[model samples]
Target chain A: MDEARSAVRAARRSDLHALTDLRLHFLGEAAHADARLRLMPDARDRTEHALPVWMGQADRVLLVGLDPAHDPQGPGADNAAPVAYAMGLLGAVPPVLAAQHVGEILEVHVDPAHRGKGLGDALVAILGEALIGRGAQVLRAAVPSTHEFARARLERAGFAPLQLELERSLDAG
Target chain B: MAATFASWLQDPARLVVVAEEGGRMVVGFAAGVVLQGNGWQIPARLGRITDAYVARPRRRLGIARRLAGRLLDLLYEKGVGTVRLAAAVQNEGALAFWQSMGWSDLETVLERAVPVEGRDPEA
Candidate 1:
């Protein structure tokens, strides 16, 4: 609600620690909601390892939402931290018919306390801009079918159902 | 497309099966590839059926089913324990086909186009 005290910007390498925390939080929530959800038990370690490479890549987009009221000194300050974040990757779309690029929103998370303040919307919008700048024609996101809240949030952001992915356990046979 | 097909045909991890009528005219084809699953869960080899098509006239002749079965056999020979595929929500025929073949519903992939123009001149 305090527009003057909140800001959203590209995440820096130093924000890796905060981003990792948020990623873990998101994964925890997802796994709690769905026992069938597949998540890395070592998600924190993987995020820490992958953030640097993602930060340095031009085709990758990472944005963090900051509450200046927490720490105005800037992102690396001891008290400064990201309350929400979004990450996306631009990928070539199989070069079928016409060469095209697609942006996949790999992760988007907003701290529970930070929800309802439109931070999630701002994060996705900025990420979409970044992807569009890099020649992405379409944006894709995969939300767990059981997560109605997440699905509604994406729909509010203009996403629509594209395809249904079906899988079967071959071990049953 | 021909070049892409040729290249895939050369990849040992990829399986491409084609059904030909009269031993010359191609009637149907199926393609799949083997992939390694991420280590988060069970470490299993996965197979994905990327594309399958049978001529419209050749649809009910069992060409598509035969091609798909052969492709699955090849993927199994390559050690793939799981297989996955996607079907457009509007394609009832395709959905029914996969479902009848014993594939279970997994997840839906949603998409949206980023507004290319209008709104926020400054991003």
Candidate 2:
């Protein structure tokens, strides 16, 4: 691969298959770091159905990162497959909290072969901008406690530990 | 606090369970919302424990333990396969209390303040 590009664009309905493929890859990789992320039988079906609707929502965003390095026989590089993706959602905390409005970064994933090329950073930046434009005062993300690499990436972007979530199986409840 | 409880009581998705031990007064409560699991991580429905409290004097009578068990019973019976709750890192007591009930560390929620357009971080 030569001349890596970090260009990104809003996802279109045509990108549904690519988005679903990347989502499963993200889940598969995450399950390695945390045993809880089992891909359900309906994972593919749920995501495919959710993406098109999300892409058009004003408070939600789906972005695709392009890596022209692998665009074959193309002059404009429009056919380059999406090598990275990031989804953002605007939400509000419970009315009890002072910081009511917030933005959440969900399911951030980049192709393994395309790492270390600033593609992930670019995608995060774009999503952050989009979320900010929609009146999000705080940006939030959650990652497996053992996934240090992902945590470090967000930390470098100025994220700090706000809270810790704990869970356990229901038998003892 | 009363209004907050009232709001939760009004919302159909929110479940507010209170414990009254041996008196007409309320002693403690556990509240949560029925939410789907984050992203596509877990296929089953999720119940997020939004608030839990037991009066100081009511501690260690196994009141909290029993209350938590009851809360989980209702959650799981309602189709929630996983339950999660957030607590401040400094709240070691809360952490220990939940740990004693089989809860363990799952995820860390990270946050960043968005820079105001006209403000400078260095300034």
Candidate 3:
């Protein structure tokens, strides 16, 4: 058995292929789900348009945890190679929101096989370090209302849920 | 719908500030949104107002009214059809402020919270 020593780092241009592979691994099969959510336009168009610009945005952070010992270096190591990852934008200091810089964790996922192995915790630590380096004092991980695993992770990481966004469609009436 | 309309009202193209007295202070500020889009498929252009905050001490001096009038002019210039805005459900003072300025509530947002795994379901 190989030693498991992984490194978590900021997304680089060289990581594009790897990141895309990871995205496709987790998200590729859900193509039809976009249409149902009316996110088809964003999925089909804006994702490609926004990735690099989003990468450049100051409040955005995309990170991956890589285990070189057990993982292959190329396309093969895309999602499978990454035991865990945390990707999302840093919150803008919007005048409306009093918080200065909130850490917005858009997506944090670990391979089911690798769960409980500290990969998720390591990824969070890396993301938290990256966020703190960028001047974020308060971190808010936006786990879905139904994600028990995510809630547990955040709570274990010392985060308490804060704000709630409630939305309704007027057209429904 | 109110949120959408509120965002529209804050559209930069519809909002403007007029500084009075050689630009020392803001005499009037108007906020609104455009409701018209391509072709006749959409209804008439709308220029909805969220707020027109004029200095309180400057009220009835036509500053507030003039600001509102100018905001309407901007909407007309943009070919807007219908305009709307809302006051908060509990903000009676703000409601009265808007009502006094001819605004009404067009929608309400209801919220319910559920708990799961010791986490706020709404968060």
Per-prediction DockQ scores?
0.50, 0.50, 0.05
> Would you list the clashing residue pairs of candidate 1?
none
In the range A67-141, model 2's lDDT, one tens digit per residue, is 746543467566666878999998877667685568899768889988887777777777877787787778898
lDDT score of residue A122 within candidate 2: 72
Writing each residue's lDDT as its tens digit, candidate 3 over B25-106 gives 7666777666553221123344566566767777767676677667766766676534555444566654565556554333
Worst 10 residues of 2 chain B by lDDT: B114-123
Provide the lowest-lDDT 10-residue window in model 3 chain A. Answer: A164-173
Ten residues in sequence with the least summed lDDT for candidate 1 chain A: A68-77
- Per-residue CA lDDT of candidate 3, range A66-110, in tens? 663454455656554454557865565544536355555666766
DockQ of 2: 0.50
State candidate 1's DockQ.
0.50
List TM-scores for all candidates, in order.
Answer: 0.85, 0.86, 0.50
Task: Report the C-alpha lDDT of model 1 over A1-173, residue by residue, as the tens digit.
Answer: 34512467788877888988898788777777755455656656777787888899988888888763454455555446788899999888766577667888877888998887777877777777678777778888877667777778788878898877766556666
Q: Candidate 2, after superposition: displacement of residue A91 in Å?
A: 0.9
lDDT of 2 at B4: 80
Task: Report i-RMS for every model.
Answer: 3.8, 4.6, 12.6
**Model 1 spans with C-alpha error above 4 angstroms:** A1-5, A31-36, A40-42, A67-78, B38-44, B115-123
